[model samples]
Target: MPLLSYSRSYSPTAADVGHVIRVECKATKRVGGGVLTKTVDTGLVLPFPPMPPRRQMLANVNEERLTPRLRQIGVFRVLTYNILAEIYATRQMYPYCPIWALSWSFRRELLKRELQSYNADIICLQEVQGDHYKSFFAPMMEEWGYEGWYLKKSRESMGLEGKVDGCALFYKRNRFILKERYPVDFNELANDFLKQVQTEYDLDYQGPSMAAREMFLSTLNKMRQRLQRDNVAQITVLEVVPANNEMVARKSQSGPLICVANVHIFSNPKFPDVKMWQTNMLAKQLERVTLNRNLPTILCGDFNSEPSSAVYEFMTRNHVPLDHPDIQHPPPQLANIYASLDLEHNIGFASAYASVFGAEPEYTNYTGAISRIGCDYRRSLTEALLLVIRSLDRCGGLRMVHTGDADSVRRAEGTPT
Candidate 1:
């Protein structure tokens, strides 16, 4: 029998979706008035949604109504990628890029093809630099039926002031509603930043302010802020909001909000200090958001450290002693993301695959060969895939979409860290 199916053919209206899904599940459990779970064949139904798909990624949904069905439904799938942008596709006969980001043409098409083959709804990417977004990614996303909204690291931000480089997030337009937009910079505004730099870094001038020593120091401090920002999760929420600003206009409950963060922390050998600061920053951000309520938040990306470090321990809820040394800042108000023992099955924790092969993963964010495999190869998501997903269940805010394995993918797909 068909194990999982959408409600359209089974239900006549949107309100009837849950009822339809439950009925279709053939639920077998006798808990409460229903079964908590069901079983299906591995080679069972593979239903592909119609093109111009209405819901390619389920970022915005009425989760309260759909939770029961989801538990009984098929596993949600997610893909965590650090697409080696600057690296050429042919470079390693694997995932590491063969050409530079600026000149990578046909090779990138191969990467896109692989992405489609995976058929994942939600994807998390790290070390994705500026060129990928401007060239290959922007157009390719359009072609693949995805709507893209990217926010650069605020510390590195240059909007209206000037430009700096960092990260981006993409989701299928049909599946996500762009509900809110907020940009956080180390400084309130860029001009204030200029003066702050002038005072702090020392006001030494030269050709243009851009060429002045003080200007360079100002840039350095801003990057330091970005480094700290990395400590905290850079969460972007694409929750349901009335498209015409109707909800706020009416002052009412609009819909559910799901938060998706794109994480990329520093790694070993590089500036470990930078990683710790930024990671702490991410933890602090999560604390601010989850303190008052159980808002669903999925923090995904590359953390160079393993499950044993203070950062990992903090995320997983193994609380440090009250007088722990590293916690110079206040204890974060948020619950550790990986603390929920129940969801341990989802957190894909392990030594990163990139680090295992005596090298690192290829990444697109850098201009050099090592980064093309993945900026911090030892921190590639593939290594901790299970731990990453399992940690989502903490606070009942995030859930794993995929339980699949990257090992199944050929070694040539990308460089192993």
Candidate 2:
């Protein structure tokens, strides 16, 4: 592939604030004896402040509640998204999607449609607000054959008078029945660790001076507060049921259980130690569940830590030393889907737009003056499959199972048997 770059600038008046402008580009390449030309059209729109409308029905009033059993046979799709909470959709974070476009009223339907398109059996979401969970996600998902569970950060921990954002998990009710739920609270764990420290070593007696003791106490208190306010994880075990009783009986001999852990780790880039601690804690929690039950585990979330961080290394590597004040036990070996599938090669660029355009994207996290848009700046589904195919490719019959996307099907077809 050849590299290409193009740039243009234009000035707009106040009247064009919310209007979308179309930009078109054409690329031509000579192949064999003919020329192949491709034209791409993109739209740039200014962010309009979101305006809240009247409260709408939580569920579809017209549609009857249908409870149909969906059979589970083989592997199912899973999706993880960090739907930016409405409360945090300020003008600073999203300069483009401001007051109008960023409102829950406008983004809710778009998020729903995008999520529906994925058709995933299990969905994990982060940063979902409390009211939105009751008024929107729970009811909407219930209507769509899913049972939803949400856990919000406590008011005291969050230092907020009202509700705050938290993680939410939704699963197809018919395909899988919830067996067990273990909610991990790092804050409580930190408190327990502090108590252990206090008991094991006398802080006052060992201290060289009163100032030193005060400093130690202050540091410990701060750490405790931070941990309490940190994001939490929910681990849910679901029993996968086959179509009929006969198939279920056969499968039940081994007791098929799927453990899905949904989490949202702390986002502060400055405090990498906190992220590492949280990741290790989560790993240990998962290990306890899986070790006891021998369940197939699927961990998903907006980890907030990048691929290169110690947190990522701890999760993916077979054995790594966790040197943290709060870490008591070694975390069990867990496989990172990306590394296990060898999809790291596909991530040559930082942003999704960069991958598509073969250059650095305008912005990865937010929309700015350029208004560049593509798939959410994350690795594409095609890239994710490349990772999945590493092990599945060995299975002859199941090599190309459910290759939905055109690019993925092409890639599968091109791969040697």
Could you estimate the TM-score for every candidate? 0.48, 0.60
lDDT of 1 by residue, 290-352 (tens): 444544555667665544345554555423332333333322321121121111111222222
Worst lDDT window (10 residues) for model 1? 337-346
Q: What lDDT score belongs to each candidate, Candidate 1 first?
A: 0.43, 0.55
Q: List the residue pairs that clash in candidate 2.
A: 47-96, 48-100, 49-99, 49-100, 50-99, 50-100, 341-387
lDDT for each residue of candidate 2 in 187-264, tens digit (9 for 90 to 100) = 776777667655544744664578866765665666576556557888998877554674655456433677888888
- Superposition error at 404 for model 2 (Å): 15
| Superposition error at 243 for model 1 (Å) | 17
Q: Residue 333's C-alpha lDDT in candidate 1?
A: 23
**Candidate 2 deviant stretches above 4 angstroms:** 1-73, 156-162, 203-215, 245-255, 319-417
